[model samples]
Target: MHKKKDNVFITGHRHPDTDSIASAIAYAHLKQELGVPAVACRLGGLNDETAYLLERFNLDKPVFLKDARASLDEIEMDQPITISLNASIKDAMDLIARNNRSLAVVDDRQRLIGMVTISNLAHIAMGDTAHTIDLLKRTPVSNIVRAIDGELVYESKTFDFNGKTSIATIAESKLKYYELKNRLVIIGDDIESQCEAIRKGAAALVTVWTEKISEEVIQLAKEFDCTIIKSTHGSMNTSRYLLFAPNVREVMTTELVYFNRNEFVDEVGRKMLETRFRAYPVVDDHDRLFGFVSRYHILNSHSKKLILVDHNEASQSVEGIETAEVLEIIDHHRIGDLSTNKPIYFRNEIIGSTASIITKMYQEHEIEIPKNIAAILLSALVSDTLNLKSPTTTPQDHIIAKKLEDISGLDRFEFAQEMYEATSNFKNKSYQEIINQDIKKFYLSNQEVMVSQVVIYHFEELDTIIDAFENEMDLFVERYNLDLLVVVFTSVVDNGSIVLASGKLENAVREAFPGEDRSFLENVVSRKNQIIPRLSTAISKYVG
Candidate 1:
C-alpha cells in the first residue's frame, strides 16, 4: 500500500538570515498548534547571526532541505515477491501465476541474486530437448519427486546417476535395447521390468500408477544402489513434469536492472522509459530487496507539499520549487515572479520583518507563544529593523515588537547589541563566507544579478578584506553566470554602507548614486527599501 505524504514544509529563502529562519520556525509552530502537520526547513546554511540567536534561545535549527523533488519513498510500490534460488521451476511458475508478478530470486540471507518471470519459466519448459536432461545432474532428488507428485519409496546411500531419461516397455527383453545406464526408467508396475531395469545400471525407477513394488525388485534395486519413486500419474504426465524438475538457479536471469529507494521519481521515470522491463526491483542501501516499482506507481505519485516564508520569488525559494505544491506564502517583502497552479494563502505586508507578522499570527489564532519562541521572534524583529532604527520599520512593527517584548521579557536593545557583536567578527571568516552569509539573487529585465550584504560595527573593517572580497566576487559572478554582482557592507552605528561592484555591469553602481562617492552611501540601512530599488532603476536605465 502507498504511504501518504502529509508533511507541509515551511521553508525560508536561500542564504537565510535571522528573520527568515525565525519566521519559519514560529509559523510552523503556530500551524502545528492548529492541527496541521508542518515542519520548518532551511534552504541553505545558517549565518553567524542566525546561529547565535538559535543557540541563545536553546532551539534547534530547522531541517536543511536540498531540493523539493519527490523521491521514490513517496510512491506506493508493490510488495516484493521473492523465491529461493534452490526452488524448483514449477514452484517459481506457481508463484508467478498466483501473484501475477515477477519474482526477485534471493539467496539464503535474503539478498537479491537474480530475477524470474513467466517468460523465463516458459522458455525453459517449452524449449526442452533430449539434451535438456543434462540439467538433472544438479537437480536434487527431493525436487524431482515434488515436481512429479510422486513418493520416494527408496533413497540410495550411494546415489549415482547420469542425467538421462528413458522409457521401458512391457517386454523385459526390449528393456536391454534401451540405454538404461544411469538413466531414470519410467514403466508400469511390472516386477520383472523393474528388476531388469535396476540390474541394467539404471539410476532410478519411476513405477507409474503403482503403490507397491515386489520384494525381489526392491532387493535388486538395493543391490544396484538405485533410488525408487512411485508416480501417481501415468508415464506421459510423469515424463512431461520431469523436464521442469531442475532448480531455478539454472534458469533465473542474474543480470538485473534495479533502482535504489532514494532515487528521485523524475529521474527514475526517465530511466524506466529507456528500458523494456515490466517492473524493476527496489533495493535498500544494503542491497536487500524492498519492493517493486512499475510505471503505474510513477504515474500516480505526487510532489512534495510546501509553505513558503520570508520571500516569494522563485529564484530566492528552494531549489526545484517549481515541482513542489506551494500551499501558502507568509512574507513581508515585495512579491516578485512566483506563479502557482492554484490560489494560495499569500500574505505579503510592507513591514519591517516577517517575524513580526508571525508573532501577530500567534495572537490572532489565540495560541500562547512559548517563552523561547517569543525570545527568538523578538530577536529576529530587532535584527531586521535595527532595533526600530531602519527606514522600513512601521507602526505595526513597533506595536508587534512591544507585544513580543512583554511576552519574552527581554530588553530589545541589550539583545540586539549581543546579536550584532556575534556577527561582526569577520576577521576569521573567508571572503566567500562573508559574501554568501546573506546573499540574494534577482532577475532585472533579462539580466541575472546577485547582491550580497554584510552588517559590521564599523566601516573601517572593510579595509582589511576589500581586495580579497573583490577577487572572490569576480569568481562568484562567473560561477553563477551573473551580469552583475554587488556587495554591501552596512554599519548601522554609522548609518551608511560601503558598496563594491563586479561583473559586466559594474559601472552601473556608480550611476545609481551620482552625487556621492562610489563606495559610500549615507542613511542606507535597508537593502530591501534602499539598495535594490536604486540598483534596479540604474540597471533598467542602462539597458534602455
Candidate 2:
C-alpha cells in the first residue's frame, strides 16, 4: 500500500491526544514488523503525560513533527481523492467510500481552496447527529471539485441522475411536447423540435450527428437556463443518460475541513478525539483533497500518503486519517476505519490483544518478530488494554504480552507502570516543545498566515506551559520568523481545551473567530480547516 516509502510516517491529529501518540508508536512498530524503515513522527509537541509515558516505557520519541513546509517537501499527492468544500452529502459519501487518496477542492484554475476526507464527509453527513463535529471550516466552497460523475439523485429543473450513463433524444416529430425538463435534446435538420424546445423548456438542444449546436436552439436553451454537453454519441445515446447530466463537480465537497499537504498526524488525532469524523480531506495550500483521511488512513499513515502496519482506528490512528489509502492492517482489534479495495491478507481477529495476534501469526506462519518489534507490540497491548483490564482484551493478549515480555526481558507490570510514569511526568517540558514534538505541521504560505499549534493533555502543566509560551514566543518569532502564532492545549479526557496562549497577531485572530473560545477542538483546533484559516486571514491582513 505504501508505494511511496520516501514519504515519512506521521501520527497525531489536530490536537493529538494520548491514544493518538500511542497509536503512532504502535503503527511504527507494525511498519518495522514488516521490515520497513518507517518513522513514528508527530506534528506538535508531547504533553507531560505522554512524555512521561514514553520515558517510563523506555520507548524512543518520534523522529520529529516538522513544519508543513518540511512535510510538503516529503510526500507526493499523485493518485488523488478529491473533495469539494461545498459537496453534497451524497457526493462526499461516495467519494470517501470509493477510497480516493488524493482529492482537491479547486477553482477553475485547478487552484485548491481546501481538502476533505471520508471522515470529514462522514461528520458532515452525520450533521447534527454529532455536535462534536469538525464542520464550519473557514475555507470557502469556491474550492470546487473538478469534473466528477454522479447519479441525478434529484434536480431543480433540468437534470436527472441516471447511474453514469446518458443519451440525447433525436427530435424527429416533436410538437408542443418539446418542452424538455429532465432530458438532453438532439435536433435534426428539420429544426421543428429546436423551435418548440426554445419556446418550451429544453435545457440543452444539440445537433447530435453534427458537431454544432443549432444557433436558434442554443439561444433558446440560454433563455431557459440550460447547460449544453455536446457529444458525438449521435444525440441518441447521450439523451438517454441525460439523467446522468450531473457534473462530476456536483458531488464533490466544495466546503470541507482539510489540512496542508504537510499537516501533522498527531494534531489530526487530537482533532479526531474531539469529533466523530472517521476521515477528512488532505489538500495542498490551495485546499484540494490531495488525499483523504479515514480511521484506516490514519492507522497506517506514514506522512501524507504512505501507510504503515498496525492496529487501525480513529482513536488509535495517526493524523490525516481521511487521506491515505490503507495498504494493509495488521491488528487484532475489530475492523476499524481501514478499507481496502480488494481482499488483502490483513491480520485482524477477535483476539485478546493485537500483540498476541501478531505473535501467534508470526509463530504459525514462521515469520520473525524482531526483538524491538516484540517489545513495542507488548508494550502497546499492556498499556492500551490496561494490562488486559479493558473488556476488549483477551487471554491471547495476555499470553502474547507475557511471551514478548520474556523475549524482551521486561517485567510486564513494571514495563507498564514505567510507561505510565513517562507519560505522566509533565513538569520540565515547554508547552510548545511538548506539543510540537508530538505534532505535525500543515503549511506556512505567503497567501495564508503561518500558524503552528500543538495539543496537550496535562492540565497540571498548563500554568507552567503558559509561562514557557512567552519564551517560545520570543524564540518562535526569531526562529521561524512567523507573523501570527496560536497554540492550543487540549485534553481529550476532559473533552475541552484551555486556550493556553495567543500571539501579537491578536486582531486577526479576534476577527476570524468573531468570539473567543468558539466550540471545542473539533470545531476550533481542527488545525488546517478550523484554526489555520483564522490565522491565515490575520496574517494576510497583517502582511498586506
Candidate 3:
C-alpha cells in the first residue's frame, strides 16, 4: 500500500455532483499517467446520477476519504521490536540495547500485553534485592538455564522453587548456617554439600564452574525432588545472572500508553506531550504491535498532499482542508474562500463544467483519451450543461462535448436522457435524500446559505411531492444550521424552475427572482450562472 504522504489525493467538494466526481477521476488518471502517485477520493456518498454513469462506464467509485489530515500511518516509525512475555530479562535487555528503544512484550498470539524499557531492565539488574527471589519463583526453569548458561543434570518431575536463593560455601559448618529450605542453592563441586542441599528441602542446586555432578548426587536430587543445574560461570557471575533470570513480564509495565496506527498524528502528538516517555508503541486495530512512534516522527511528518477539482471553497472542501497542502486546483466556478500558502497551478475558467477543462487538458498534452474516461467526462458535461440548454453552457463546452462524444462513441443526448431517467424515479427515496442529492453550501454576505437543485422531465412530477418537499426543507434548514435553504425544481422540457425557500432569509429568495408568487423563474436552469449570481446580489442588497 502507498503511504498517505506519498500519494496525492484528487477530490471534489463535499456532496459532490456528477461534474465534481468526474473531474477528480479524470484528473487523477492524468496525474498517474504522468508518473505521479495519485488517487481519486470523494468526501461524501454518491448521488444516483453519478452512480449510474460510473456503472454504465464500468468505472469503480473513488475511495471515500473522511479528512485530509496526516495520520500515524503516514509517519516514519521504528520497526516493531518485540519480545515474548515469558522471555528472560536478559533477552529483553539485549533487544533494548540493540535497538536503543523499549520493547513491546507480546503474548503467545503476538498481541501487545506490556512494554519493557531499558529503565525497567536496569532496575532489575542493579536495584532489585528483597523481591528478586520472589520474581525468580515465577520464572521458568528453561529461562534460568539459558540466563546462566547452565546444564540441567537432573530434572525433577515437578520443579517448584520457593523464591529463596543462597550460596553454599566450601565449609560444611558454613553450609549449615545457610538457610536452604525450598531455595535454589549455588555452590562448588563438593559432593557432600550438594547432597546436603538436596536433602535440606532445597528446590534446586546449581554447581558453578562444574562440568558434571556425581551419579549419587543426581540420585539424591531425584529422591528429594531437586533440579540440579551445572553452570559454566563462577559463583559470583552465576548468582548475578540468576538474579535477572526471571521472565520480563515481572518487570514490564503493564499499564501502557499506546496509539492506533490510524490515529491522527497531531492528536498523538498532543497526547505525547503529557507524558515523558521517549517513544510509544503504535498498534493495529487488533492491538497487534505495528511500530513505535516518537515525538521526532511527529515533528518531521508532512501533511497530506491534495489536488482539488471542480470546487475550491473551504466550506465545500474535505474536512481538515486547513491542515492539508493544496498542490493544485482545477475548477470552473468563481473562486471561493480557499487560499494556499505556496503558489500553485490553479486553473479556473468560465465554463459550464470542470470536465470541459479536464478534456482540454488531455488534448493539450496530446495523450490518447481512454474510451471509459471520455464517456464519464461526456456524462459530466451533459449533466452540468443540461445538454446545452442551461445558461451556463458555453460554446467551448459544446465543442468539448462533441470531442468527448466522438471518442466515447456514445450519443450525448440519449445518454443524458437515460441518466436523468435513472435519477427521476424517487419512489424508493426519502425526501431528505432527494434534497441533499445535489446540494451546495454558499457563504453570502455573512450568511450560510444552501441551494439544492433537482431536474425532472416534467413539472407534474414535482407537483405531486411539493408538500412533502417543503416540510423536508424546513427540517433541512434546522438540521444544517442554515440562514436560508432553497430548493429549485427545474423541468428541462419546460425550461423553467419552481423555487421553494425556507429559513431566516426566505424573503431574500423572492427578492432575488421577482414575480407575483415569487416562486417561479422562467428560462432559469443554471444554478452557477443564474441562481448564484442573483442570490448573491439579492443577499448583498438585503444585508445592506
Winning model by TM-score: 3
**Candidate 2 vs 3: which has more TM-score:** 3
TM-score of 3: 0.94
- Compare candidates 1 and 3 on lDDT and give the better one: 3
Report each candidate's C-alpha RMSD, comma-separated, in the order given: 3.8, 22.9, 2.2
Poorly placed runs, candidate 3 (over 4 Å): 172-177, 190-192, 516-520
In candidate 2, how many Å is residue 174 off?
A: 94
Q: Which candidate would rank higher by lDDT, 1 or 2? A: 1
Clashes of 3: 0
Candidate with best lDDT: 3
lDDT for model 2, please.
0.50
Tens digits of per-residue lDDT, candidate 1, 444-524, equal 767898888888877778777778778899998898888999898888678778888898888787888665544577888
Q: Per-residue alpha-carbon lDDT of model 2 for 1-544, expressed as tens digits? A: 5444454464544344344555566566655666776667664555665566566557787756434222432433335554444444445445655765434565655566655445444444344522311221221121111112211211224333112122324444445444355333455544555566545554334445554556675565566665454444544454432322233343344566555656555566566676665446566666444665555555454534434333455433554455554545555433545555456556667754444555675677566666665666676566445556544566677777778887777888777656554554455655455545433333333431234444333456555446666667557655765555555554423434444334456566666655454224433434433455555665577657
Query: Model 2, 219: alpha-carbon shift in Å?
Result: 88
Clashing pairs in 1: none
Residue 37 in model 2: lDDT:
63
TM-score of each: 0.84, 0.33, 0.94
Q: Against the true structure, candidate 3 has what lDDT?
A: 0.88
